[model samples]
Target: MTYDIAIVGAGIAGASLAAAIGARARVLLIEGEDAPGYHATGRSAAFWSETYGGPDIQPLTTASRAALQAGGFLQPLGSLHIGRPRDAAAIDAFLAEFADTPVRLERVDPAAIVPGLRPEWTLGVSEPSCAYIDVATLHAAHLATARRAGAVLATRAPFHAATRAADRWTIETGAGIFQARVLVDAGGAWGDVVARAAGVDPIGIRAYRRTVVQLRTDPPAPAGLPHVAHIAGRFYFKPEPGGRLWLSPHDEAPTDPCDAAPEEIDVATAIDRFEHVVDWRAAAVERRWAGLRSFAPDRRPVYGFDARVPGFFWCAGQGGFGIQTAPAAASLAASLLLGEDVAVPVDPARYAPGRFGR
Candidate 1:
């Protein structure tokens, strides 16, 4: 049978888009893994910071707040952008960059960097409005909404190939042959691979591996501590349960698409970075994992139709902001899929696939 829209790769991008468009279209969410979000969405930092994606992404991040907060998926946990004396200029640049946005960031003095921060971080910026996102809950809720609206979700249905004819896409996958009026390439790390299989040229979408580790601190991580990141963009850490802290070396190594695993060197680098920012001892590493953060050449998400391939939608290249900006991303994508205008004022052309040229 044919569907109005068939979304490939049911991660946050696919799942959220499915939910958003299900009400007005016949939606089919196809996932290669046995479950949705087995990749990046499942291994997220689980935090929602407006400034996480830089200035270009703040609009989407800001637009998603209302929907994310509707279900109480956001937990209040402010953030600290700590930096050294040499980093003062970088801090000033960051402030100037987002000065017009709604995100609240204030100057943090050396004395204000307390609550366990090391002395080396002499200058900083603090955002009191940031919070931790309940990713598991958000993913589940979106999938459920899609199902309730009559969207079909197929797991373990790895997409193989596709051919377009007479405005219909005949797709082959592990499940079976299916047809769709519009094909959405939300394949995450394999977005370009999927586009190529669907007879579209690759748009230079690349995937990079990012590593994170959980460390046990000697003084024990306090529950009241805010999430912290280096102003120069080297590392970030946040409090975890059982006196542990979630830290990352913020390493973004170029890598091929696959099930990502953390390297020992990356973990060691993370611990070493953490030690420099805090006087507390890192007792031991409890857990470590890595995930792919896919991105376009310009580092912005691509969320429109393929200019060369009719009926093919490009909804990939979410980078690290996929979970944080899910609501807005999906809404914008759904609007374009349905040939409607977006609720937000931001132009969709900024993320259009046409920019790459066919």
Candidate 2:
């Protein structure tokens, strides 16, 4: 059976695209893992903050809010961007930059911040629109939608190779042979690798490792401690159930495609940064996990088809913003694939793979 589309990497990117593509075409969603989203999507920071990805990506994030809430994928949890006196100028610039955007930032007085925050954190802003994302729920929903729409989802099916001939692609995988007219490289960290395997030129996409550590705090982590993060990107922390605090040092060290594991230094650095931000002492690291956030050289997401490779679509390089932007990102990608107007308001050209000289 020949499918209209064969998408690699059944993470959020692929699943969401499959869902968006709907019953319009015969779609094949493939994942090498035993289950989908074993990488970035499953290990996401799992928050929807309009300020998370800067101005270029805010449009996608904002466009996804309605669908996220309507689908029961959002939990009310405000975000806090705390700044030190030294960060005054940076904080001011951030507020000014998003003044007119959908993200609403209210200046926070230092005295009102969480009790344990250090005195140096004198300036802060509260973006009340921010919310915790129910990532697993959302990912499952997208996969379910795709399945209900007749998209074939094959897991534990590692892609072996692909060849294009006579206007169709013959794909070899662990499961079996499949033929598709078009292929979507939603391969996450291995996006470039997938492209190369398909006889398509690589687009220079790279993956960076992000580490998250769950800490057992001395004072017992507060349940209502808004998603607090340093404006300058030094660190971020949020409350987890079980009185633990999820913390990251904001590390973005470049890494090759692999099942990522947290480094000792990364974990230590996170705890140290957390100590500096608040007076609460970390008693022990309850657990730690790492995921790779892939990106193009310019850091914006890369979408659209390869200009040089016919029937090849690119839906990679979403970085940490993958799950949060899935709704709009998938809509935009599906539109490009099907030759329709993008449901999202942003211009698609900026994210096109051709920008890399394809």
The TM-scores of all predictions, comma-separated, are: 0.98, 0.98
Candidate 1 structure quality by residue, lDDT tens digits, 1-358: 8999999999999999999987799999989999999999999988999999899899999999999999899999889998888987899999999999899999877446456677677887889879999999999999999999999999989999999999999999999888999999999999999999998999998999999998888899876788999889899998877878899999999999999999999999999988888888999899899999999999999999988889999999999999999999999999999988797657898889888776
Pairs of colliding residues, candidate 2 = none
Write down the lDDT that model 2 would get. 0.91
In order, candidate lDDTs are 0.91, 0.91
Over 1-358, each residue of candidate 2 has an lDDT whose tens digit, in order, gives: 9999999999999999999999999999989999999999989988899999788789999999999999989998898898888898989999998988878889987548587778878888998988999999999999999999999999889998899999999999899899999999999999999999999999888989999988889999876778998999999988889888889999999989999999999999998888887888899898899999998888889889889989999999998998989999999999999999888999999899888885
Model 2 segments more than 4 A misplaced: none
Instruction: Tell how far residue 87 is off in model 1, in angstroms.
Output: 0.9
lDDT score of residue 6 within candidate 1: 97
